[model samples]
Target: MKRLLAVLATATLLVQLGTTSASAAKPVRSSAIQWMGHSWWPRSVGGAPGPSGLWSPANATVDAEGRVHLRITRDRKGRLVQGELDTMDNGWGYGTYRWEVASDLTAMHPEVVLGLFTYGADPAYGHREIDIEASGWGRTPITWDYTTWANGHNPVSRTPVVPGRSTHQFEWAPDRITWTSWDATGALLATRTVAGADVPVPYDESIGMNLWVCGCTSEWRKTPATEVVIDRFSFTPAG
Candidate 1:
């Protein structure tokens, strides 16, 4: 966790609190990274993607298959560059957010990380963040970490990411938040829920996706590239 825990440059995070991740990012290949019917803005915080290295909008692009690709690469300067995107909509609260991953996460570099989550910039409700992240964090057998933060405490659920298409989701309401995972065949991989005051209330939070070199240069020195593909993101308000 540390500074990267819930800290996502609140000043910048707030800018992405534009609209819900509905049908807006349209998939446009070879140019702008428009995909899945929503608008996603590629961003760089302090010239880097949080916790280290540089960021390039080029690393975030849409494929001909209509998938969102988040990647990490070594630039001509030998600088490790990562990628992240913020949804261009706000007004989202208390809803079910789902992301379908098309990559084989288990094959990714141990130090490389991919995250899909909702976040805000204020201190309330721990930056109003909830995350579904896949990374080994220098460990083997890449795992997916599901987390909900409140104040400074974060409740997490870690589970192995299966091969093939996988869907990660969280349903947030006024009283509770439910997290679930399903494999390509719709087999339940894991599920967990948190209720009461700890479950963060929805504010001006929006969706985001990122791929970064987690262990920094020490680990990335060996492999300067990695990537993950997000098939699409969908949201349904908790009515």
Candidate 2:
């Protein structure tokens, strides 16, 4: 009787150990909006069918390492699905928003757009926006564009996309907004600044990050399914 009891106890211990090991090996996936204090787009709001794509909570997740992964793919109906996370409230006056791109933006399909921007369009407050968009079209060269839009003035600057892991940032001030791209080693790849009248004035808007397909461009619609991984995102209030 004692020998049988000992054998059963040993078997139970082994099972427990195996369960622990398996749990440790699996990455934990959590909601990106809840973890990062952002909101999923196009769910309750009505808008045009293409730019925002179809946002799915299942498409946005935070891995075990706390990195946010935004995936873009197609559903069974051949509809393009994407991921988007936006802040809950306006960023107020001036501040800096920074995030890291874990995927190779330069290698993405031309139709794919990784956007970091401030969005607001209200007639009472006037429209205001600032954007840093990275896009590629099939085998063509990838490009990054920094754009600022207001009621009357909208300016854009284009540059070659930087490949590999990199940090991208946008610093918004009262006078100017600066968009910068840097590699993993902290070496700056490109910088674009919009100043004077082109800068977006004070308005109520939330910062957002999205991985979506551009439907307006006919060639962009040809891109295959892809993903965009984000290592981190932070906001620093301006002094």
Candidate 3:
């Protein structure tokens, strides 16, 4: 009888251990925290940036001064981790999406692509993505690129990004998307409007901001860590 009782106790402990293990593997959820009047959630993903990359929630934070800061860091496992945030809710459409960037764009890491734009899951409704990226493509002379993509067509406009704090904007309207950027002293750096078939209808896309390694070249396989700060992000509805 004693041997049977011991076996039952062991079975009960095994079940409890299984329950604890399942709970520990669950994903973390953040819904109460809001930044810049928008609910943003950080990603914890792998299998990106050529071969592999990680997005750590700790690498994305908002300061007491109300600035959004994104960084690339290393995890406890010695793997490279970066910051990427997306709005929790979708359908921010047909308006002016603007941000004030505090990072100096003249000097940036060669493999880094600082992206601020909209993304959609479905390819049929919207174009799936629009990007305002600051990248050097793993080389010198980092510049800002306004890219519009739809139906396998991708068009990009490159422009110089100045030093100090600057403002960037993309106004999505009925049939066009106008992109603009300014220098620290309120001087316009770039402006262009993209229309025609490549323009998306702003159907079901959400805002996203990420500081990630560029997969455009072989540089994504290297080790690099950096950060970018944004003063604010605002949206003005179309009139």
Candidate 4:
């Protein structure tokens, strides 16, 4: 009888241990985002029905048929550059975002790009910024040039995503920004702060993706048909 009782006690202890572990596991969360539009970029000029970056008018709307296009070029020495113009103006713009990188990716070189024309002229908004480039080989590191001004200066924050395979969530709020990355079993790899900056003035100017071809030399090393696609994008207002 004592032996049987001992066996029952061991089983009970195991059950309790399991229960504790289950409770210890962290929870994962995703953002509440709504899709505004869906568009695809073509690898070639003639492959799809789209407007070339050269033809982007004063105000343009990206359609569902993969028609919106940006002109990409290689310099004399072969480098990637944004075409001739900065298409973002009054009506053309981008919304703010909260994002999370998937944890399952062993390596990711995530980047956020904003389009502004400043080729021969002064920097856009009279300032420049480059922050947070992580975990990619041979890719451009996160970098930007910033110009300071009076009253309220520009400030920015970069959020680092953990390295592992898991689904993560990102939320951008005025008071605080939240991020969570979890594994297949829903174990949190890392949850932390996202880098941000405060605008000195009211920047009502629009933002979009723009680049000049000759200004960049990195294209020589990259292959053709190398197009960067922003798979998902959205915005959430501060509360």
Candidate 5:
């Protein structure tokens, strides 16, 4: 009887260790950003005009390596989902913003948009905004746009992005804004410059990034589970 009891205790210890090991092997989910937030916008609630899709923190994650992963998938109700992050500071001014696309964006559906932009008010208020968007725009894949709001001015570019990492940057100055995209090899893919009257000046807005479906419908985004990884993001204020 004593030997049997000892063996049972040993088995219980082994089981506990196994459970602990399994838990440790699992990847840890990150905490939400303090200054950044996300939202879920349904199709009925003025969806197509803005970041026009559903968003949840569960669809965004920062791994131990500090890479931000924005995922798009279908929910249990068959609704298309996406992810967004917006800075809490609404006092963003003239500066340089840069982001590295760590995933193969070419693999994503044409309707999938990876946007780096700034937003203030609605367009009716002559809202000042700038965008570096990668999307199919209801066409083929690997299309990009550098746009300025308030005037519907956008320079479209069709550049084949390599299936890896790349860089996108914009410099917002008081007189002009420059947008550039670079391939993984550090080669320039496309660029757009807007100056003179087209430059959006003296506007304060929050800088944001999102991975969303264009029309919140499968007609644009055929893939159910899509993701965009951002390796790094930085902002430099003007001196």
Candidate 6:
């Protein structure tokens, strides 16, 4: 009888252990990266195939469900260039969404392309783009603009982000129709009122590239290739 009780107790313990392990494996907020395949890799514009500068795949990776993983890194000369193509129907077509970039902006260049979305009227309904162009200057901030063939404009906002040491978070809550930014310390840097009226949703919009580049004013620098380091990128439903 004692041996029987011992066996029963051991079985119960094993069952409890299994339950606990399963519970611990539940999907966490940060780890919820969907696998996005090669469909999103960037394509060059000209005959050379790619932008005027040079770009290549990094330590970044992708998964099965079409979620992408990337680590943005600088080159030997403290420069980097990387971008991905828009392969899926991003939230811009319709619906509310949020995007987050956990970035370390040190003594880098004076320019960055955090994210972009195309907005314009065309049979293509495609070539339009919204840009979050940032310069390394704090008080000068960065710029956000939406452009199209028929109608387009550039609007600048003062972000006052400190370079050399900072992790920043940028968010867009379309339901609220506003954009917000916060520092690593959770301090609000700037807030801009965005409206469906002001920035109309592109009917078939998509997320293209958690991208960054060196030139904000011109094409690539004097060099043929430049690169930047990206730690990771994530997108979630924005309230």
User: Over 4 Å off in model 3, which ranges?
Assistant: 1-28, 125-127, 216-219
Residues 1-239 of candidate 2: C-alpha lDDT, one tens digit per residue: 00012332232233323344432212111221454554433221213325543666566667788777777777788767776665545535588888888888776877777887766533222346677778753335777777776535353666777768888788988888888888878898888877787666766566667777766466655567888888888778789
- lDDT against the true structure, per candidate, is 0.73, 0.62, 0.70, 0.27, 0.62, 0.37
Query: What C-alpha lDDT does candidate 4 achieve relative to the native structure?
Result: 0.27
Evaluated at residue 91, the lDDT of candidate 6 is 31
lDDT of 5 by residue, 1-239 (tens): 00012332232233323344432212111222532132211111113332334556677667778777787877788777777665534546788888888888776676677787776532321346678888775556666677776455545344666677889988888878888888889988888777776666654465667777776344753655788888888888877
Model 4, runs deviating above 4 Å: 1-95, 98-199, 210-223
Cα TM-score of candidate 2? 0.75
TM-score of each: 0.84, 0.75, 0.83, 0.34, 0.74, 0.52
* Candidate 4: Cα lDDT at 132: 18
- Superior candidate under TM-score, 1 versus 4: 1
Residue by residue across 93-207, what tens digits does model 6's lDDT show?
A: 4333333333454333444444433322222322233444344422224433223221234353545544332333334443323455555576666666544433443443445
- Model 6 has an lDDT value of 0.37
Candidate with the greatest lDDT versus the true structure: 1
Return the candidate ranking by TM-score, descending: 1, 3, 2, 5, 6, 4
User: Any idea how many clashes model 1 has?
Assistant: 11
**Superior by TM-score: candidate 2 or candidate 3:** 3
Q: RMSDs, each prediction?
A: 5.3, 16.0, 11.9, 23.5, 16.3, 17.4
